[model samples]
Target: MSDSTAIFDTLKAAIAAEEPVALATVVEGPGTGAKLLLHIDQTAGSLGNPDLDRVVSRDIAGELAAGRTGVRHYGPNGEAREEAVSVFIESFAPPPQMIIFGAVDFTAALVRVAKVLGYRVTVCDARPVFATTQRFPGADVVAVKWPNDLLDEIGHSLGQRDAVCVLTHDNKFDVPAVTGALATGVGYIGVMGSRKTHDNRTVRLREAGVTDEQLAKLMSPIGLDIGARTPEETAVSICAEIIALRTGRDAPTLTAGVGPIHR
Candidate 1:
């Protein structure tokens, strides 16, 4: 098949299967009308030159991960900022996943926020009573399983587009949840707790074989420091933090700030 036909077919299949894919089309300057179909595993077409295709693919992957669509400029041979080519990258990404390792009241609020933000959410807790579908109606799934077991089963499916939130706060549940999530490639791992709780958990986590480098990925006291006092407000704060993380934005987080979280 021709490149155009192959790209069209691949794009349709990917979208139908709810797979992440991006299309980069040169709409201006050199190689106008050139196309490149980018998927997580492979590329279908090219943006004229290999360098152009490679550069655009990297940018496309970032846009796809963030579920964004925009036009980008580059030189004829992929040099930065020369504007010799204008490639419009259109991302068709499946909904990002947010697996919350707790079924507390805060988990329900977080499920609502994550659903509103287009995440496919899952609420998991070892307590079968707490992990009911009715309690987290907005969540896509609910599992009454241990955090480590659940993570072991589904962790391989997680990518940089996904997130894992540990809100159990209890040492028995929270520490194991954090370590399990750290093993996944999920872009965000937020743990809910206070300053003292975090300090105490850090000691336990270190003993659990969590290294400083892996511990750095934990967004303890998890959320933007917006004085969120209630569950609903904290839900918003957490969702905002996720967005800021995905877009590489600088925001004041509870993790970085000191003092009381309540105003």
Candidate 2:
């Protein structure tokens, strides 16, 4: 088969397997229509020049990691801040992940809400009986394991598009879960509790070696100040908070308040 045909086939296979990949096409440049297929650990095809391919490949990797797609400009020889070449980098990333670290009532509601938002949900808890497929029917993964252990295994995979929610509300579970998640690149790390519980959890997280900078990343008493009392409503509030955080919007979060979650 031809080189283009081979690249197209590989791209198709990667997308079919739900793997992270990016296709960079020189949309407006000397080598228009020239394509480069970028994989996590490998690459195929090239946008005409070796230097151009190298630079675009590096960019494609970053875009894929962020689960983003867009156009970028570069000089013909891969020089930065130049616009000689316009490559359209299209990222084919798998669904973003949402790992809920509890099997509580809020966890079930969050699972359903996350599914609606197109997140690949995983319900994890140390108790096997609580973390069952039957309890979380829509979850892609139901893991009966310690929160820290689970994060240790898959934490590296978490990216800016993913989320980690700690809903255990117990210091024994929340401390380790928050500490583990703080080490990951996951964009959103939310913990559920009241203001008092949030203060206590914060102390424990600091004791567990979570730096103040990392502690700032945690959205304790997690969710928007939307008067969300029920689990389903709370799920919406949490997901909304995640969106607000990602977009850097000005939303009233539970962390911003001084008193109770609800009046």
Top-TM-score structure, candidate number: 2
Candidate 2 regions off by >4 Å? 1-5, 28-34, 46-68, 73-85, 203-214
lDDT per residue as tens, model 1, 1-263: 38789999989999877788999999998778889988776988888899988888888888987779999999988989788789999999887899999889899999999998888898999999899998888888999999999999999988887999999999999988998998888899999988889999999999999999998888998999988888999999999998899899999999888987665
Error of 2 at 105 (Å): 2.1
- Give the CA lDDT, 0 to 100, for residue 175 in model 1: 86
TM-score of each model, paired residue for residue: 0.74, 0.81
Candidate 2's residue-wise lDDT over 166-250, tens digit each?
Answer: 9999998898888888888899999999888998888888788888889888898899999998999999999999999989999
Return the clash pairs for model 1, or none. Answer: none
Name the weakest run of 10 consecutive residues (lDDT summed) in model 1: 254-263
